[model samples]
Target: MRREAVLKQSGCRHYRSQPTHGIGRYKHLLPPEPDPKKKDKLPRKEIKPSSDHEYGVLNLQVSGYNMILVEHYSQYVHNLCSRLSIKVQECYAKPTKTKEVMLMQEHSTKMFLDAMLTTHERVVQVTGLSSTMAPILMEVLMMNQPEGVQLLVKEHTEADYQVRFKGRPELENLVASMS
Candidate 1:
């Protein structure tokens, strides 16, 4: 009785009737159709290297559980590049990452933190490296790599720069709107 009274006051005619099967019954609640004449935005293009070398810029990322070992190895790589006459653009330390290991107790429903491992990372940027010299550098670095240390070498792109920083979409939108 109260529902019908409220519905009648709100000017609803089909308060107790079954819903219709046709799409027109809910057309007012559906989103408006997009304009077919409007053109969609295209993705931004990435900058390409101009040189003929395999990679215009190479990043040697070294990471390890031991901070001292990771730092020393990165320094060694920088020195080795200088000895090989490769231009070392920059050497910088990346932020340290920590991971927690959790273990479940026997016959228990709770989990506890067993250990925490912290990893340190460093990157050595080398520019103007030739295809022939890259292999030699990799071979030497791998042979001398310390225990528990990981090394990765790849071409540096704009994505690498973006990954180093945190994303702030609101700030980006504000800047775009201001421009």
Candidate 2:
């Protein structure tokens, strides 16, 4: 009550308004208030604590000369992981070929990779060596990579997290569908 009087007289237009705009005369009707008494009293949200037990896979990113080659290598890795009873996330199941035109796919993929690293996610990218192209691509990629990346490495177990991709429309939509 006293605060309102101070605000009204102090010429503070923010907390109190002058007779202007559509509410010129009816300013009293629209009280300048985030009124405590009139507050909706929304129920406090109770956040359920996540269980200590968690399951996740070791993400093995397989890239090669091409998507086909990468998929082949990925399959081999998958089989090996299965044999070793290792939890593998299989995020690389369907390889999006470079030939298939995807909208800003390179940028999106880069963003995804950056997010993965930022979150301290355990990711070991394995590039298949079909030919010299792998080396060239590696060199190009290495150019941007920071020196002493070993320091960035963080360890995790299968119990740490789960991996899934909420498909991006840019990458998901077909070239024909886009138009």
Candidate 3:
């Protein structure tokens, strides 16, 4: 028996007819629609808002064992130094992120501080501190840090309140006094 005749006898019209590519009437099969809500949602893996901590700088003037706390995470430290166009003599990394890096400059504290204050307006804007407060903070640090004191920073925020003096027994005694 012929295949077409057999198919026709079985009541199967599709197999009985010749197959056509695109010229015949075809049954359309549409894909399922996507969920609208899922498409509108934001991704969950973005950086968290609370994670503000970042790499920070520590400005110091260390002469021998004596270290001076110049400035903390404030822009005064970074911007002022950059404006003064002073090159860093050395950089020492801190043991922890919360700790400070030791920075040594070639010039004296008075000269360095002058450059820092000269750019006071810019420094205040960059560090998010008032112009008046910047000078006062510098004054405090200069008066507090003694010979053989090691300057340390507390992290991303510049020198301000987060600055400290380490090294030297006398400085240690002074640090104890500050507390």
Candidate 4:
């Protein structure tokens, strides 16, 4: 006897036979369809801050023991900001810093130079950024940051700018006396 005829003759009202092939077998696992009435409601718009409100300047400093990685990461940041329409005021490299590692000789009080490490630094200056975009930009940059590269984001200040120059006590004294 056929399956349908046997099911009908058996008087099983609650047991419905489902298709045994393809997606029909998994119909029960699928999610229910959404209500058409709910689709008419529009999505709420996000409110943005006023244009006159200033978000100030930000400095992104990337440093690493490897010069190539540091430069490449800095360039990546610059390109990302440009794509996001954020203003990049300047991009520059700071003077490279070097440190000497010394090791103590075996059973002796004398020390010898073991290795030298040089740290390279690059800065990307951004201006006219919105408050809402700052965190998002930082998160994206940090997520893609390379290994051994340190990223620092801080407000730009006059003291930070002055740090790039060598301090001259005589010039400062002269300016102070004139004032």
Candidate 5:
């Protein structure tokens, strides 16, 4: 009975007034007007890592001496990229005349090279060649070595700390020994 009396005395139902749009308030509720300039804006160019640049044949005449030029390039990369790790992923696969074979080999070599470079947590692909195009290849790779480089030397195996960068020659030797 007390609850019923309190409810009767209280007049709270339907007391709130409907909201009206104030000055400039209606614009907030409407869809945004399209900008003609923004609709025609040019697409932004993608900034990929320097190592991710397309592999190109580079011919550099670094004072006509290839090895010296390569050493200089290597030193430059090492000095410049103090923060990033630098490594050389030397690829020594035999050359194939066939386009398909060459492309596939190049692709595979690059993938392996990338993996080896990544092991050091570096950021460049240093593809080297000791062929007629050696100088050119060195130049190209050096150009791409902004952050650092993985020197992928082709057709040369010198045993110091390593034979090849990924040590394919060493692996071959082990396999042959096992056989």
Candidate 6:
């Protein structure tokens, strides 16, 4: 009672302590960060990539059905290979009504498609694949798709490069005018 009277007379209020609610109260939960300082005066050793540490991409084409469905299916296949400890990278087509491979920009697009087959790379070498693992990859891809969705898979190779690079010659004039 006396404490209450003294508080009232002094115009001071008692507040109950709380753990935290908003960011302000919770700031102290983490240790205060160390202030930035100068770097250590020692040079670090560098490790080079050996043949065993290298990787390569498996070029595939997913088409003959809904573009959206095919892209998802391709991603599904790539993901399945990764889970099985198989090294795989993906190249997918965007949603287009006519099942055409639309080019966003040649320079960037080629890196994911046309260039994969041509480049003689240490980390991304190209390899020809037969039915050893292809059937399993396709079956896994189909299981993930809807019953109505149909997909076609084929190995993209140098044979298809000219066809894509040539593009729609007739539309060339129209495309150039827009740019």
- Residue-pair clashes per candidate, as listed? 0, 0, 12, 0, 3, 0
Angstrom error of the Cα, residue 92, model 1: value is 1.1
Give per-residue CA lDDT, model 5, range 95-129, as digits (tens): 11121222235435552222211122221223322
All-Cα superposition RMSD per candidate: 19.4, 22.3, 24.6, 22.2, 21.4, 16.2
The window of 10 residues in a row where model 6 has the poorest summed lDDT is: 116-125
* Native-to-model Cα distance after best TM-score fit, residue 112 in candidate 2, in Å: 30
| TM value for model 2 | 0.25
- State each model's CA lDDT, in order: 0.84, 0.39, 0.37, 0.82, 0.37, 0.46
In Å, residue 58's CA in model 5 sits off its true spot by 20
lDDT of candidate 1? 0.84
Off by over 4 Å in 3: 1-126, 150-179
**TM-scores, each model vs. reference:** 0.64, 0.25, 0.19, 0.62, 0.18, 0.36
Off by over 4 Å in 2: 1-56, 89-91, 94-179
Ranking by lDDT: 1, 4, 6, 2, 3, 5
Off by over 4 Å in 6: 1-59, 94-132, 165-179
Can you write out model 4's per-residue Cα lDDT over 1-179, one digit (the tens) per residue? 69779877866544346544344356458898888778564343222233555456778999999999999999999999999999998888887889999999789999999999999999998888887788889899989998999999887776767565556899999999999
User: In candidate 5, what residue range of length 10 has the lowest lDDT sum?
Assistant: 91-100
- Structural RMSD, model 3: 24.6
Candidate 3, residues 16-112, lDDT tens digits: the string is 2556634563443556677877756423322212223321222343222211222232323454444544333223323121223344567645332
The digit string of per-residue lDDT tens for model 6 on 78-148 reads: 66666755554334243233322334664564522222111110111123333455566567766776554
Determine which window of 10 residues in candidate 3 has minimal summed lDDT: 116-125
Q: Which of the two candidates, 1 or 4, achieves a greater TM-score against the reference?
A: 1
Top candidate by lDDT: 1
